[model samples]
Target: MVAPLKVGIAGLGTVGAEVVRLIEQQARTLSARSGRGVQVVAVTARSKAKKRKLDLRGVAWAKNPLDLANDPGIDCFVELMGGAGEPALSAIEAALKSGKSVVTANKALIAKHGLRLAKLAEKHGGALNYEAAVGAAIPVIKTLREGLAGTSVHRVYGILNGTCNYILTRMEQEGLSFAECLKDAQRLGYAEANPSFDVDGHDTAQKLAILASLAFGTAVAQNAVYVEGISSITPEDLRAAEELGYRVKLLGVAVRTAKGIEQRVHPTMVPKSSSIAQVMGVTNAVTIDGEGIPPITLVGPGAGGAATASAVIADIADVARGIRAKPFGRPVEQLRVTSKAPMERHEGGYYIRLMARDLAGTAATIATRLAEQKISIESIVQRHANGVDTALAKGKSSPVPVILITYATSEDAVYRALEAVQRDKVISGRPQVIRIEKN
Candidate 1:
C-alpha cells in the first residue's frame, strides 16, 4: 500500500472543523478514489482548548499555523484561516516556498495575491489549489481551469453571494422591505452582524475577480471591478422588475469586450425565464458563455461548512493523487494584464424608476432628455401614488412614480440623461437605475 498523504489544517472554524470530520468519516472512500489514504496529521487554531465535535486523538497540534507550513512531515497545508493579511497569507507563502502542496478557501487572499502565490508555488515545485474560494462545492474553478480549457470563454457571470441572494429572494417572495429581509437574514444566520462585505457587493467582487482571472487568463483586478451594493434596492424596485418580467439579483459579471475586460458587481435585472433567476435562497449559480457551445449554467449551494469543505477536500484529493495544474488555468507568467473596460462603455438595457412631480410637461421633459442622449425607451409607465409614503405624497401635489425600460444603450448615455433630468428638477429624488441582463 502507498504511504498515506499527511495533511495539516490551519484554523478550526466551521469549515475547518467540518473538513476534519469529513476526512475522518470518509477515509476509506477518499483513499479509494484518490489511490492514497489521506490523514490529518496536525492541526492549529486560535483557541485550541475550545471544545470541538470531532475527536482529535491522534492528530498532532501545531502552536502556530506557520509551523505546519514548514513541517517536513506534512505533505499538504490546508489553510482555512481566511484573511487578506497576517498569518494566513504568510503561512500559505511559507508552505508554497517549501515545496508543499497548498489548498485554501481564502477568497480575499486569492483575489489580492493569487498570481504572485501561483508563481511561488510553481517555482518551488508545489501545487496551489483553491477550488473552495469561488463557489463552494460548485466546481466552478475546476470547470474553468480544466473542463473548458479548449474553448474560448467570452463571459462569466453569477450570483456569487448567498446573503444578498437570500435577502433578494425574501424581498421578492414575501413582499418585504430590504431592511425587513436583512433582519430576517441576520436572524437566520445567513448574513453576518456587519453584513457590509456581502451586502455591499465586495464579497461578490472578490470572487468575480478570481473568476475573471481564470476565465480570461488575466491578472486578478479587484480594483477594476465596478461595485454597486444592494443596500439601496427598494421594494418598489423589486415590484418594477417583477412587472417587467424580470427578477432582481445581485450579480458579479465579467465579459471580454472590444474595449477590454469588463468586470462588475451590482444589482441586475434578469429575465424571469432565465436559469439564474430560478436560483434562490442561499444557493449560487454561475453561467459561462464560451465558444462552440450554448451558455452553460451551474447551480448549487454557494456556501456552508459542508459545501465549502467538500471543495477543499476535492483539492486535497487531487494533491493526494499528484495532480498538478496551473493555479489559474494557465501559467502565471502567461496571464496578461488585460485593460479594464470602463463602466461608461457598458451597453445594456436599463430599468429606471423615478418619482416625477405630477405636473404637465414633466414626463415629456424626461423623455426629451433621454432622446437627446439617443436612449430609446422600450416602455414607460406612469402611476399615481395613492396613500403611499408621505414624502412622495407631500403637500397638495402627489409625486407620480414613472418607471421606464430602455433598449440597449451605453451607460454613459443613461447617466447623462438622468443627470439632465435631475438638473431640470423634473424628478423629486435620486432615480433608481437597475441594469437589465437579458440572459
Candidate 2:
C-alpha cells in the first residue's frame, strides 16, 4: 500500500475542527477517491485546553504553528488560521519554503500576499490551492482557475459578503431599517459585533481583488477598488428600486474595459428578473461573463464552518491526487500589473433621489442642470411634501421628493451636474445616487 498523506492543521477553530471531523469520518471514501489515505498527523491552535468536539487521538501537538509547517513528518500544511498578520502569514510562508503543499481559507491573506506566496510555492516545487478562499463551498475559485481556463473572461462579479447581503435582503423584504436589520443579523451571528469589516465593503473588496486577478490575469489590487458600503441604503431606496423593476444589492463588480480593469464594490440596482437579484439571505452568488459561452452563475452558502471546511477538504483531496496548478490560474510572475480603470470614466445609468424645494421652477432648474451635462432623463417622478413628511409641510418652504432615472452617461458628467445642483442650492440636504446595473 502507498504511504498515507500526512496532514498538519494550524488553528483548530470552527472550520479547522470540522475539517478534522470530516477527514476522520470520510477517511475510507477519501482514500478511494484520491487513491491515497489522508491522515491527520499533527495539530496546533491558540488553546489546546479549549473543549473541542473532535477526538485528537494519536495526533501530535506542535507548540507553535510554524513547527507544524516545518515538521518533516507532515506533507501538507492546512492553514485555517485567518488573518493578514503574524503567525498565519509566517507559518504559510515557512511551509512553502520547506516544499510542503498548502491549503487556506484566508481571503485577506490571499488577497494581500498571494502573488508572493505563489512564487514561493513554485520555487519550492510544491502546490498551493485555496478553493475555500473566495466563495466558500461554491467552487468559484476552481471554476475560474481550472474549469474555465480556456475561455476569455470579460467580467466577474458577485455578492461576496453574507453580512451585507443579509442586511440588505432583510431591509428590502421586511421593510426594516438598516440598524434594525443589522441588530437582527448580529443576534443571528450573521454579522460581527463591530461589523465594519463586512458592512463597510472591505470584505467584499478583498474577495473581489482575488477574483479580479483570476478573471483578468492581473495582480491583486485591493487598494484600487472603489468601495461604497450599504450603510447609505434606506427603506425608501429599496421601495423605489422595487417600483422601478429593480432590486438593490451590494455587488462587487469587476470588468475588463478598454481603459483598464474596473473594480468597484457598492450598492447597485439590478434588474428584478436577473438570477443574481434573486439570491438572498446569507447565500452568496458569483457570475462569470466570458467569451464563447453564456454567463454562468454559481450560488451557494458563502460562509460557515461546514461549507468552508468542505471547500478546504476538496483542495486537500486535489493535492493528495497530485493535482497542482498555479495559485491564480497562471504563473504569478506572468500576472500583469494592469492599470485601474478610472471610476469617472465608468459608463452606466443612475438612480438619483433629491429633495427638491417646493418653490417655482425647482424641477425645471434640476432638469436644466442635468441637461447642461448632456445627461438625458429616462424617467422622473415627483411626490408632494405631505406624502414625505408632515414636518416639512409646516416649514416656510416644503421640500418634495424627486426621483430621476437617467440614460447611460459618464460618471464624471453625473458628478459635475450634481455638484452644480448642490452649489445652486436647488435641493435640500445631500442627494442620494445609486448606480443602475443592467444584467
Once fitted onto the true fold, the runs of candidate 1 whose alpha carbons sit more than 4 angstroms away are: 386-396
lDDT by residue (231-282, candidate 2, tens digit) is 9999989988898899999999999888889999999999999999999999
Residue 175 error for model 1, in Å?
Answer: 1.6
Worst ten in a row by lDDT for model 1: 387-396
lDDT of each: 0.93, 0.91
- TM for candidate 1 is 0.97
Cα deviation of 202, candidate 1, in Å: 0.2
Total clashing pairs for each candidate: 0, 0
Query: How does model 1 fare in lDDT?
Result: 0.93
Worst 10 residues of 2 by lDDT: 387-396
- What lDDT does candidate 1 reach at residue 12? 96
